[model samples]
Target: MTTIDDLPIRDDLRGQTPYGAPQLDVAVRLNTNEHAFAVPQPVIEEMRKRLDAELSDLNRYPDRDAVALRTDLAAYLGHGLGFASVWAANGSNEVQQQLLQAFGGPGRTALGFGPSYSMHPLLAAGTGTRWIGSLRDPDFGLRADAAVAEIHRHDPDLVFLCSPNNPTGTALDPAVIDAVLGAARGMVIVDEAYFEYARSGTRSAISLLPGHPRLVVTRTMSKAFGFAGGRLGYFAADPAVVDAVQLVRLPYHLSALTQAAARAAVAQSAALLATVEQIKVQRDRIVDTFRGRGVQVADSDANFVLFRTADDQKAVWQAFLDRGVLIRDVGLAGWLRVTAGTETETTAFLTAAEEIL
Candidate 1:
């Protein structure tokens, strides 16, 4: 009876598709750019103790500001950053949503360099902000001068810069950030979701926060920290900018259990993060092996590699899937992304590629 066009929905959302990666059943899944390692047992035990302690207060609201968690996050970041300069949410997606809500909406505009993070435009649209897709170099690099010129052309209310960009797996040049901040008249958000995996000599935008109040640098515990299941992400900005987001965030947004779990994870970060270097080794090995075999592999500072296939990307992806390995076909014509998984997972993918390609 209700099979006709659905009841009233936002005019902007009529034909929109939700953002997601395929969740398929496979033996070796290297699709989502997740850390290949498991959380250390000691960290899990600590989180269990913390969560068990919080079970008694289920009736009461969580710390609305998540002050203790923020303090720990501040300490973890250690760029002279403090709790007042930090904010946290369910994940980087939620953190991005809060940002768009605070600074973007009807009559506002947000800009992102094309092929960076797909979620940038999606989140802007969800917030009712006009989304402008800008350009990048042929190699997917965002050069500073060209980037600054585009910022001048759009003059949007908000801008997004993704370092170690998704689907491309390359780090941004710090100068591009400086140029955008200088040329743009509004808020600039540098999404550093993969910052922890960046190669040496890579600079973080958090270092630029001392004087620039308009910049926000977002990070997550999902990647290098091995806390994806915990659903924790955060950002660092000026105290004033941090306070502005409070105008839009739901009261008691983070649950007590989530906060406790994240706190325990952060406390054991050293042990949890020891796998980063090991993962990096496998990542470099992937690049070298792929390139040596004549596949075009993009230089990567992130924990994944974006390689160009000589054959159809869909066919390649499916071939990998058929062989019990899963990687992302990011819709680039000749490209696919593979997360830097464990040594065995990496070997399985390479072995599959050798046979299939």
Candidate 2:
């Protein structure tokens, strides 16, 4: 009998941990940047109503292209961002993969700014593409000069920009992003997974799509739309680019149930907007609380706050866990990230931090 180790594996995946969020059981969980609220009753009822209608079709495969959902998504985006075209996947993660499949492959490179989303490199690896992470400045802002120079040097096939980025929770400057875009010879994918939580007037690269054929902006319902478990995300790009993603996507990827659920959520955008407002309030309060206690916090435009602690980051994480709180220990060595939850949970997190710090 052959031992398992004797079997050949993909050379690229010899020692890789696939992309995933942390899983932990804690009373006041703030680790994964999930929305602190549930889908509103009206949205739930609407979903149930649509599901009732679609249950008859469960015996068959879902619409291969999810055309109706796409139309609804376009309408939803038009209402929110004043843009009318959109495409989607099971989650933004899948959308990201579709992007790689379209524009990146073996020998081509996927470039990303450092301390941004962790998924870019992992996805690139899985696609047999080279991944390059360029470090940002100490404040987590993109170094426009270095980035432009590197883009010219590497000439990557794809570049990922996570605005109001993860872990550090900072947005890339519009001017800097524009410079990189100008210098890039390939597709630029901007992940706006935290858009709703960002302050008003924060610029979105989506607005620049008309002039940039190589740009795509991806958004997720998991963060601000309170649909993490529902696993829905969408992207807006040039129709040609959207067509490229359509080519690589699996058949019937979005189930009828998921379509119903997403449609329901989109139909009730007002409620989601209200909840986003509340989360922003809580987020601002958390940032203030951390600053008052002398904890250096990143100026976040997302629903989470990242702070630096002089104490051992691992020790701080353990202390929070020991106190029934759960927060993400980002790889920044001395930094940790906590999501904005309900008022009570935020208070508990503060209390736990007070003890841990």
Candidate 3:
């Protein structure tokens, strides 16, 4: 039997683990931060119609630039953005990889606050970009001053900032973004995959795009739009940035069916995003439930709750699985993360947590 060790693979990827969470056959699976609700009937019907319109064109290639889909994404994002300022791909992960390809490569560097979206470093490594990591405050928050100090010290070619950060649901203060933009010499990628679930008045970095061409705010339809299966993610940036990324984007990267369905979903945004408020409710419940039990819970602005598990998070994770609930153990000691699922799922999680966490 042959293994990767026997193949001629890149030395940098010799012993790295791939990024993933368990896709288990459990009752209440809340590991990935996926929105709990299914696509509404009306939106589903719309998507069906959209996909139907593309079935006959399957033999032909899609719009090379995905211009129509980009237009719809721009409208959905609407911070005075036009299609020229937007781009889309299969998912936000692919979009980030393209950004890395365009701006980061061998000898260049990417910097991020640690315990963020784990994929950032992996994407950088695959692009041959050196990754520089800095830690967040003990409270799982990043201060503007601290963020700026690290950026000035590293001056990396790319800076990755994740809001409502994963593994710790705390949202970054806009001040940190402002400070980093002022200090960093390279591109700043803001991952807002969970922003739609954020508490009220949590500002988005999209509002900061007017004067900063180097800032990129990436988003997805996976969470709020419940279009994860459709796999659409995008970003809002200057037209020039769009031009740069296109240089590396694969030809016809987004299929016609994906483009049509996403546009249709955006056209019926009201129906597609109706579950956001309800998900936020469940998220708040998770936070309160855990904190009430005297556990340390990070204040969440995303759909997941990151709380301290008793000394051994792995055991706690297994215990939840034993109870037919699946949560995430993000390689952080004594910490586990759970997505805020439907009310029933939340109840199941809380019931098991009562016995476990």
Best by TM-score: 3
Give the per-residue lDDT of model 3 (tens digit) for 1-357: 999899999999999888988999988889998889998888889889989989998999999998888888888888888999999999999999999999999999999997888999999999999999999999999999999999888889999999989879889889889999999999999999999988889999999998999999999989888888989999999999999999999998898988999999899999878889999999899888777889889989999998987769998899899999999988888889999999999999999988875
Query: What are the per-residue Cα lDDT tens digits for candidate 2 across 91-189?
Result: 899999999998899989999988988888988988888998888888887777988988988889998888989878898777877887899989999
Candidate 1: lDDT over CA atoms? 0.92
Q: Quote each prediction's TM-score.
A: 0.98, 0.95, 0.99
Please give the distance, in angstroms, between residue 2's alpha carbon in candidate 3 and its true position after superposition: 0.9
Tens digits of lDDT, candidate 1, 155-214? 999999999888787798888899899998999999999998998888999988888999
Which residue runs does candidate 3 get wrong by more than 4 Å?
Answer: none
RMSD to the hidden true structure, all candidates: 1.1, 1.9, 0.8
- Kindly report which residue pairs in candidate 3 clash with one another: none
After superposition, which runs of candidate 2 have C-alpha atoms over 4 Å from their true positions?
Answer: 1-6, 79-84
Q: On a 0 to 100 scale, what is the lDDT of residue 116 in model 3?
A: 84
Best-performing candidate as measured by lDDT: 1
